[model samples]
Target chain A: MTQTNTIRVLVAKPGLDGHDRGAKVIARALRDAGMEVIYTGLRQTPEQIVEAAIQEDVDAIGLSILSGAHNFLFPKVVELLKKEGADDILVIGGGVIPDEDIPGLKEAGIAEIFTPGTPTSRIVEFIKENVKH
Target chain B: MDLIQSVLNGEKRGIAKMITLIEKNAPEAIEALKQIYQHTGKAAIIGITGPPGSGKSSLVNQLTKKIRSEDKKVGIIAIDPTSPFTGGALLGDRIRMQELALDQGVFIRSMGSRGALGGLSRASYDAAKVLDAAGMDYVIIETVGVGQSEIDIVKLADIVALVLIPGMGDEVQAIKAGVMEIGDVFVVNKADKDGANRVVTEIEMMLDLNTEKDAARPPVIKTIATTGEGIDELNEHIKKYWHQIANSNELAKRRKERIRSELISITEDHILNQILSDKSSKIDSMVKDIYEKKIDPYSAMELLIAPEK
Candidate 1:
């Protein structure tokens, strides 16, 4: 069953990553899945991403980081979300994250990590299943 | 009436509504802006722009913290790319600056480029005006930073910082001529990267070569925005530029130019819309005729512009 309100997502690239093909692909996939997605073009800071999520009243925030700055960037985003009273938002990530770092990311409150090759359907389904209206 | 009053009182919903109205070019929004126009001019607008990978958002986050430390209210309007097919904005930049969301003194808004020719959303101008009228001490307009169109920020900001990063191959050449010319302050962000000094030197050389008699030579500052290094100096430079603009006649002249440009844009849009609406069928027929070579496009245009005989 289709939900009455479309889930809003803020998909962003953090750090100096110039590779945004994945971000663009995901943004398109999410839009195709009947969600409203805001794609911050590239080189966003954690602060800018979170600010956008809150301003757009997005239900989820997805960050794509490939610049090897995930260790520093993800935690900062989680911290900012907590401070902003937006902990309710489902924070997810995708990029060149290693499997070993996934645990630390989860521990830091990132709801999920969808690596490269993860199906867009899975992302849509995960949000549909987890995000509370 | 309530919308106008609420906007003047700085209500968020009211401000949002006014922006929507302005974006649609609604008459009421024009009236509301007229009413609140006198209350503006208090906000110091800073434009953050650079090549796409220049870490502008991170720099903005650092700037936000520095500004907040001074007990000033800040507003940020980040322009994100809109999907060509779906008309949706992927608001990725806002996620980078989430820390300030909880700050009562800070307000952030993200806009979609929405296929606008100028790389900025048409609504961005009105949104900035709304933030200005809402009593923000500082308003930062961050563009997607793709060349020519990104230069629009110069018209909207009191201080424009052009951010650059090392390791972007041929960055000096990649930098748009328009953005290079408009930058009031140059920032070599991600300065911890290799060849950071080289980037700074290159920027300095460029600045030296480009300095004009009438324009102040922009300073190039090295910053590692991620770690907040050199942010204070950057902030100080921004303030100094603001003060310089305030103390001189340049600010007034700039504002006049902005208003003039806005007027021209509005008139153009209005005339185009009116013409399209009034002669939709005729225009379609003319287009079809031109496509079939039944009439030349120039004569069709002449007929369209000529009053009905």
Candidate 2:
């Protein structure tokens, strides 16, 4: 029997960031790649993103944070997910983060960071290869 | 079994996992649901639907806050459309209720319509079941109410609130007939906008015309979701309707009807899958025969269903 499962992903925009063009584009691209993408819309808090991820039972969470608060916010999401015992969920960060910030983000439990100009296909491929379930 | 037990214990992850299983149509989903079936039917399932810009999400957010203030746990399912071409969905409804994310008493999920019209994805019903079993006092389903999908809400929810914003002339005309029949309560959201009372009047007139002597006419309440105005009144009406139905046979009848519909739908999907699965050769031959006019579509169907018969 073919045991197939849909790759459920939540694309969230965390913090006071109002820019969602990147998030929306990636969400549409992921959907086009045959994955179910739940776009949580603009201006989401880290707590909200984690809560949504847990409730939606998503395999991965794609955070689109354009604000400079990634250091505080991204780690907060990772921390919340861990506290809730959902550390198994794959976490990826995207949008306007410096190269130096990437190391800190990954260290904070973000599995991958995709900066600007990264094609949606790369993200899609990565998710397909890395989804835990 | 562990997951089901956790769901019954109101564990967020467990409830979420079960909803995901149902959405993916997992093979174990049926058995899992069966195990937790006895624990469901406790929460009041409320359906809120309206046009694209009717502020349904904002209204639901306000309603959730009110329900939480009364010390009730809430489960929310917001339905968004799936791209028929791509089979993916952009579920953005939960954004409006982000403030409730920190509150452990609230659980919100955004569901893709998954090609099932009637304003709900098939998985939504099961998600509600999971939430109900999780001991939520209310499970709110918010859907785009413009089309035929809204009718499905009346079947799944104990109370259906039809939300309309002022100045949506075409929207009112488009959904008036179907919505008038299904809405238990009519809400004029964005009441701060112009012509709010006109929309209310229009709904009242329709309700007056359609209500039978024995049928209770649905009350029309004005609300501005942005400012949380009139939500209390709307909440009261929802509670009142729940009370009226709880003591009456209507609740049981609706649940029975929902089960019947769900069974038929599942059976239909199952049989269709069976016919289509690994039967490419059979289907190709049938198609070729039909294209050549050697067999009609009806004859082909009969042949396909012959074994089952």
Candidate 3:
């Protein structure tokens, strides 16, 4: 017999961004929504984030970058996950990313980028709907 | 068979997949774990447990680095608690172990206790076996911040290191009965802080009180995990303990006891699953009867068992 499955996600801050309020909020919100979230603390590199994701075997990686490094940081994580053959992990973004950067990020394999003021429920629903595993 | 073969071949992804399946209790997992069990008992299993903010993760990181210096593979199982209400957990142990993630020789997995008591998820036992079958030289299980009774680690780990930091007063009374006896090696981490020596003295006093005069007393070592101080000493102690136990029949005795308990638990789960199966007549209607007080839980359980027994 099988049991109800629990989805695991990784929440990370991949830059010199010191403030982690957004990441903590999403982690807590996901916990409230009944998902396990692995929180990699601040100042993690793209390589570190991706490695944690694979080791955690998470269904998704939620990257929060406020240092304006989404251009370099977010895509770098996605690329690393790909190189490791873990591209199936849903990659999403949040924080102060600009509208102009969202398209480039999507092209780079970020499924969605939630800018400021986006509701936590949207992130939860996006994960619930998009997580393949 | 391919997945089992991959695990035997030491592929990281395969081990990861096996652990995930085990975590979910997938139907294939029991069969897969049964095969994997043949390859276990080779790796050195160490369990570390202490109170919150006791530097367990940092100490584990240091110990891993030290072990890797010898060119051995290490598998880390770090546990955290799950919120009972939401069935969710924020597993932040990896936050202290980020640097070790990229080390191919090091495979670290975080687990939420999933409402398991005694500070570990039940699946951690199978996950440790997966790592062992994959040929890791060392398997380190770090428990969630533990209290007195969270000594279940002793059953799984060949040796248990109970890490304590300075500044928590009344330490002796805190772990007097529960974890105090379970620890094979006591570490006073964050020794740079004040009162480290006092904590050491307190532990020594407690150890001196142990009446097993023939047994080796667990050593109390001081460590600054952030700087990797005293980890070599701790590693040496762990190795020495292994050597001592290896030369005797103690290791086999411990393993036999461990497997016995594991068998009992797994069988109990299987029986319980059958009783709690999705058939509406089984649990759902019984739950309603219990709620309505038409039947008490104990009698309902007897009734449920009556038909089969």
Candidate 4:
């Protein structure tokens, strides 16, 4: 069962993406929206991301990827979480992902994928509405 | 039982899940802890606390690497502050610790203060317990030292290392009152910067003033966490301090006091939940009366906590 009130989210920059500007902005947005945000920083592996999500007890995992490995890394995180019985954590992806890959990522269990120019408010709203609190 | 068994077997997922359960204060957390408690008390818990920007996280990262090099399994709990108004926290300590994220022997978890007044989450100690039960040789708790209440780390860590840096005005006096007695070791991180020796001297003088006859004074060391300089020395001091306290009655006393405080905190929360949830309880009326000045808070408090009729 989920904790009452606050929603915890893990904002991770995974798979060798050194550009953390987007991740940092989203992290601050989530914090300002009254959700606890754990930023795992850049260069995190998919294994590390899922493990962090589980330990932080995040309601959602927001994967910010830019190295063209979203196809490989994004689904790997969802796969690992599911393998560990943590499919309950809603997984979402963002950052430099193409529209063509969106369907594939969603099919791989990503709840939603936000591309560049997506409003922070929409992300916050989506989380508030979707997190299994 | 499955979780506990997996944790005992050093399964990373199991340890991670159990720590999450504790952080959420889920009902199953209690059951999990009951089973895990017996396997704990083996890991040497170290507390690394300092003011924000004092390089506490970097120091922990360096120390974790050193400990891992010695073939020791390490568990890290980094506690970041939560906004009182929003109940939100940005836990970025893992940024500095990214180097160890891939190490199988190093498990790092970032925890929000969760509005705990003491600069640590209520579940920090329990999370450390989970790591200890999972067979970690060293469990380091890094707290965001936001002045005053950072002393709470003493109750949870076997050795408390207070991190200090240069150029912070009155650096010694700022933490001296609230943190002095709690420190087992003192560290001057970012030692390559100017005024590092001054901070070291100040702490040494403070320790001298509080020295007890025949008691081991808290040792202070200097380090540049970014370059990992003096990390070996810092690790040596940590091990020395742990060795000195390991067999002492002081260690036992500290653990006992920790448990006692935790029990009281748990009971206080439980009673508060009960008071808030029972619509028939007089607490609501007492609060209204107090607000309207029909009764003073002291008298209202008595009525509010009085036995139910």
- C-alpha TM-scores of all predictions: 0.74, 0.92, 0.94, 0.91
Each prediction's DockQ against the real complex: 0.16, 0.62, 0.76, 0.53
What ranges in model 3 sit over 4 Å off?
A: B171-175, B278-303, B306-309
TM-score quality measure for candidate 3: 0.94
lDDT of 4 by residue, B193-285 (tens): 989898898887777687488778888898999999999999999988888778788788778888899899879988877766774456677
Q: CA lDDT of each candidate?
A: 0.80, 0.86, 0.90, 0.85
Can you write out model 1's per-residue Cα lDDT over A86-121, one digit (the tens) per residue?
788898999999999999999988899999889889
Model 4 clash pairs are: none
What shift in Å separates residue B61 of candidate 3 from its native position after superposition? 0.6
Better of 1 and 2 by TM-score: 2
Model 2 TM:
0.92
| C-alpha RMSD of each candidate structure in angstroms | 7.9, 2.5, 2.2, 2.6
The numbered model that scores best in DockQ is: 3
lDDT of 2 by residue, B87-141 (tens): 7777778777777877999998888787887778888888899999999999999
Model 3 chain B: worst 10 consecutive residues (lDDT sum): B273-282
| Candidate 3: tens digits of C-alpha lDDT, residues B13-53 | 88888899999988899899888888988999999999989
Q: Evaluated with TM-score, which candidate comes out highest?
A: 3
True contacts kept of each: 0.29, 0.75, 0.80, 0.63
Q: Taking chain A by itself, what TM-score does each prediction score?
A: 0.94, 0.96, 0.97, 0.95
The residue ranges of model 1 lying beyond 4 angstroms of the native Cα positions read A1-28, A33-54, A57-133, B23-28, B171-176, B292-294
Instruction: State the lDDT of candidate 3 residue by residue for A15-96, as single tens digits.
Output: 9979999899999999999999999898998988887887788999999989998898888888888899999999999999
The backbone clash count of each candidate, in order, is: 27, 2, 0, 0
